[model samples]
Target chain A: MEERKVILDIHNFSIAFEQYENGFKKTSLPTIRELDVTIHEGEMVAVVGSSGSGKSLLAHGILGIQPYNATLGGEIIYDGEILTEERKAALRGNEIVLVPQSVAFLDPLMKIGPQIRKGKKDKASKEKLDGIFKGFHLKEEVQDLYPFEMSGGMNRRVLVSTAMMGNPRLVIADEPTPGLHMDMVRRVMAHFREMADNGAGVLLITHDLEQALEVADRVVVFYAGTTVEDADVKDFEKEENLRHPYSKALWRALPQNGFQFIDGTQPYVKDLPEGCPFGPRCKECTAECKKRIAYREVRGGRVRCIHAV
Target chain B: MRHHLLFIGKNLIRMILLLFGVSVAAFILVSVSPIDPLQANVGQAALGSMSVEQIEKLQDYWGVGQPPLQRFLAWASDFFRGDMGISLLYRQPVLEVIKVKLANSLWLMCIAWVISGVVGFVLGIISGLKKDTWIDKLIKGYSLLIASTPAFWLALVLLMVFAVWLKVLPIGLSVPIGMEASGVTIGDKIQHAILPALTLSITGISNITLHTREKMIDIMESDYVLFARARGESTWSIVKNHGLRNVILPALTLQFGSISEIFGGSVLVEQIFSYPGLGQAAVTAGTGSDVPLLLGITVISAAIVFGGNLIANVLYGIVDPRIRRGGKRS
Candidate 1:
């Protein structure tokens, strides 16, 4: 219960970018719409989504890599303090590091040692990173080798080392174990679990539900850029408690659960349904579903489906 | 070290082919010219009185009477052995004439080379790291402006502005044109080279600026750069350590591609400043149709090109390890 203390509190966050054309008229595309999400210390939150679910955009928001042209509407508080631009740069790489998808994540031309040592002057960063590299069975000599010289496994280890070098409180991994072998996935997942145990929040984003089920304490399922389901991993296991029609449908759509594929496409943000974004594709849809966005809460979880109550 | 050597060997092969192609074209162009050096040596008065026997003998002496391949091979062999014959225009040993000029040109070129290379590379990285920001826009504007303008035109403009308007450096001549009795000392000669060297560098420096900036932008988008950022690396570290190094890959590999430009710049700069350089010496040889002098200059130019490209290749191979690993795919 003490661990539930908020590490990040993002409220009503919206981001829009202006596009210019035809000699100067500009229009905005609102990507994130009133998104409210939070993460407590030592938590593992798996962001579940299909492609283009705005998962990466959320990561960009947290890291402040969102372009200057982007108009952000919301408060992002880190440790009870409003996260400003100066804090964003300072927090990045040390306070909230990222582990992006590709194994070739380290610079192909530079050696690992100097690359890892870069921009990090703090104590916890250097020591913990050195420990992780040694713990991962990666040799110290590898610091001299270029990214291309390292094997896929070695590169994976080196990437984890570099991210941990900052000893960040939050580690956002976008499909961390994608394209990796099954053996490597377990090892990577174990590393994430160890990180969370050591007081770092691990935000692992992935489309692979089974992997998420393995390591995540809780999960937030994104549908059409909206969090349709937020619940403990156990809440996802119960057949009766799979309350959201979308969540139930998603549960049914799992290959292991005997369904081949989900029946329809996600709702377009621009041409979204008046009520639930999933209403168009939901088998339990009714005429009343067209009036408002779905919002419902089960005993131990929340879902954005009207009929779920 | 082993990989480095292997890359050097591979690069040497490529340089040899490139130089061979260039040398063949140069040989044909120089040989088929309208004015023959032997005829050039003998004025209009001697031309009418010269016997057919003497004319053939003169042609034979210059090896023009022999088959093209034979003459080229003989010339290449002797040229490599430091026997480039004599200049018909200067009436001096071709080696003796070109040596001092080549030395001076090399010195000026070397300085300009270091300056442009270092500054362009560092600026390129900075621009890429600040992509889409005002800093990036400013560098992009500067690079484009420099790249699009012609070198000689830029030279004249700079001369008028810096030398005439500001009076910082001398103009038109290299080191007191009278030729001091002891022949202008090394230090004075260098002081005289400033304007011409700067004039020679405009295009090359600009080209380096644009090219490195563009290349670094491509490198910044690379996965590794993203990876570096993900690792919590600072902007400066990413730009310097990651962006610049990878961007320099193609630059390193294709380095010899610019040697011809440098030599070409030297030719123009020499004429503009009236400084005595091997490039202008070659031009003087060509205009006067000095056969031995012409051959010597042509051969030496080819050799310098060959040598420069060779160095570029060797250095490239050292920087890029992939070339050493599989030999070709990289």
Candidate 2:
């Protein structure tokens, strides 16, 4: 395979929030630690994890829109340049776009047309938005209505249209297909795939691995706030081809793989083990597993487990 | 547009019915009181020397000799025709008495209302943006202090300081006594208005400030605001365009309730400064058992309050698209 140009490169990323525990006794709660993910030009990368895996935080961190108390560590590079706060502010909504998870993210008071156009009243912008809306099956009159005047599915379509309206080079879609029917989910995933085919780097964050594998070029599995494995879609064809123990477990849990179940839950951030976050639940636990493990490339795939063959 | 018009029409009818109910309640309450308008108008010495025929003649002149229901009906009919009846104390037409004083009170309260609203909104935004910081703490402390302190006492203290001690403002009244009513300049009205307006504004400013602060903080944390930030919108633009609309819609509803506070606060503040507004006239009517004057002021006040609320609802429809569009389908 030809080496594609890197559009977004995130390395050793960490996110911690400063919170008041009890009456001004402050503590730092580290949610994401030592995370790494990279998106290449013309590629759709899916970051798949269950709830509490901090997948959404990675999107917010990339956008520089993290909450005020959240302290971010490590570097994020966009097109070979350091993505500083200033650069993020400048490029956001133009070069990079986020399809947010909640329908509530749409301003209830604002009309759909102006919001998608970002208040641009010019003829060309309006025409372009109308085209996008038509593509999404939204009526011309829907632009005059408020978010509260629309259904949840309609609002989600509007959100997708918002990202489509902008000529963004990178699209971060955070659980964009939830509550959607199977056909609608496939349709939305096809939109992301189309964007990647047009050379935009797309990061599709979802917990549904089955759906992700249908569209994504690469799958980065997150477990307990850290990346456990980065494998191509072909690697997910069989459990043996996957590198991480957790990834193998996840693959076996799929209905096609006999629906094998893991016993323990992913530990909370406060109770996370020192080395491998999945150590407590891994069958290959040893004394060496208690020490910090670095993500290493094995068989052209990245894995965090040392004993991966 | 047609739906909005129908909604407004319905609200107007409701307001009229509310005024009728208020008139009936006010008439009953005033009629059941022990004081007699005839006795209140005539002195105690004159009452002792007067004959029964003279007393009956006095009651007839004052229009209190009729049954309460009969009197109320007559007054209501006359009110519909724009005749507010006659004041027993001032011995003048009630409408005439209220016209000038009502204008003066409206001007004073309007100024106070505008000043307090602007100041409160700015302070609220600041406190909300800097929540849990020293600036927010100071604003909270100030609002708490003002809320706890009585408006009347605050007026008196302000009166003593600004008028008597500082000698910077006029002591009492809406205008100087000898100036021609037409000749009285805006400067003169403002000079006399400063203390009373400040007195009326303190409690309202504090109330609105705290309410707006709480509302803005919640709105700033809302998902839409975070989304806007992620869209690369500047903080000021987001606050002004998005945050203020949501915050001020609820604040506007709270402001309509403050109309009653303006009237209620004006009574004491007007009496304290001898400012001749409707509140002072209402107080004088109460003390002297001037039944027609009291009832007239009550009707006018009820009309203003109802009108204020109607205006607020209309403004609410204009500000909130959800209400204007009659909510979402499914």
Candidate 3:
């Protein structure tokens, strides 16, 4: 088969914030360190991490919407071109869309229609919006209502409709299904899957491993602000097939796989130890694991652990 | 339709009650004041030389011999019939004097109010959008300085500079000296009003500017604004679409609330300029103990302030859809 075009290739991505310490002392906190994710045309990639692991930061960093104090260190290659700040600005809403995490992201004072349309009043745009809203089961009268006047489910659908309004080639959904019921979660996931089926690159940043496995073709596991493994979804069928120790542990902790958990929590970014971030909690940790570990390929999958074969 | 009508009716009743309360308060306070309307209006020597019958006639004419409640009742009854009584000091009908004086003050006040609101709102938006920069710092410092400065002091300074030394504008009054109402030009009225109106405008700008600046800052930092930026909206577009709507409502509320402050400030400003506006007339009535004229001015000014607030409340419904849609939150 012919190789699919790489739509988004993010390598060694890291984000650090310039913060004030005690008495005006300045410090740089590396919240995301040496993360990597790549998605091909028509592929759905999920970056799965728990809260504070900086999964959302990756999405913001890719879109160039990081906080004012954040400093980025990485090369985000999109459609074979280096994604500069200007390029991100140019392609943000037209080519690359973000389905934000919450209903609060919608402007409270604005009407639903003009906001989704980004104030576009052309006939083609309006017609496209009508079709998209119809598909989402939103009525014509709903367009005139405010976001606060709608249910959470309706607002969630409205956010999804924003991505579809424009012919977006890359859709970055950041924790789009938190606090949602399983049925609603599946519905939102299917909308994203449809986007991918239409040949767009969809990057879904989620914390639920089961949800990620349900819709994503590939999963990148984040541990302590780093991607420890990048494996195919089929690799998660058994714990032994996973390359990284953390990914194996995650698979084993799934309800169908005995719900076993490892000891110790992920280290805070400020107190991360030398070498492997999971070293202190790994039963198979050796003195060699104290050195800086590099991400390398092992049996057609990427892993950060030296012991993985 | 019924909801709107009910809202208006409720506010109208409230306005009547408010005016009544204000009139009674002004009457009681003026009655207890030691100015002695008979002595203030007529000379002290004239009072002593008057015959007993003449003295009784003067007391009765001034309503000084009647009980406070009875006098108030008499005034209220006459006021309800559109009769504001006669000004003892001006020797004219109280309503007629107020109408003429109010016309003089209205233009001065309206000019000041418009200039302050427009200029302050634009400066506030610029300062907030350029927060933490030199422009923001400069506007903040200017607003603070103006807010702290006394209106009378500013008025005096402007008068000294423009009228005393510069000799560019008229020193006082609404028109050129010795000019008849028929002969006086609009240009002459404006020139005389410039100093007093400038004083009022300069002082009024600071409150709205600072308040709008604070609100704009809050809006710029909100999550929706951030999302707008992420949606590829230019900074100007975000402000036009999001920031303006959020901040304008609060600015309007502050704008109307400033009316009373403007009316109060006009009193001192008019006194300083000697301009024959309602504020100057109010001062003259108070010092001369023209009870009828003072009471008339009190009722009118109270109505204006209350009316401003009522208009603001009504406009809130038109401007904000959340309020307009009426109490249904999902």
Candidate 1 chain B worst ten-residue window by lDDT: B321-330
Best by TM-score: 3
Against the true structure, whose DockQ is highest? 3
Instruction: Estimate every model's Cα lDDT from 0 to 1.
Output: 0.73, 0.87, 0.90
Q: Report the lDDT tens digits of candidate 1 across residue range B1-330.
A: 686687678866776676556657667777787766666666667867889898777766655556767767876677668688776668688888878778867877776666666666666667766788898899778878877877677768877887789977767666776786488787777777887777666556666766777787777777776656655567677766766667777666434556767787788777766778887787887766665676666667777777776677667766776655336434
Candidate 2: give the clashing pairs. Answer: none
Model 2 lDDT vs. the true structure?
A: 0.87
Going through the candidates in order, their DockQ values are: 0.57, 0.61, 0.62
DockQ ranking of the models? 3, 2, 1
| CA lDDT, candidate 3, residue B17 | 94
Highest lDDT model number: 3
True contacts kept of each: 0.61, 0.63, 0.57
TM-score of each: 0.86, 0.89, 0.91
Which of the two, 1 or 3, has more DockQ? 3
**Tens digit of lDDT per residue, candidate 3, span A192-244?**
99999999999999999999999999999999989999999999998888998
- On the 0 to 100 scale, the lDDT of residue A224 in model 1 is 75
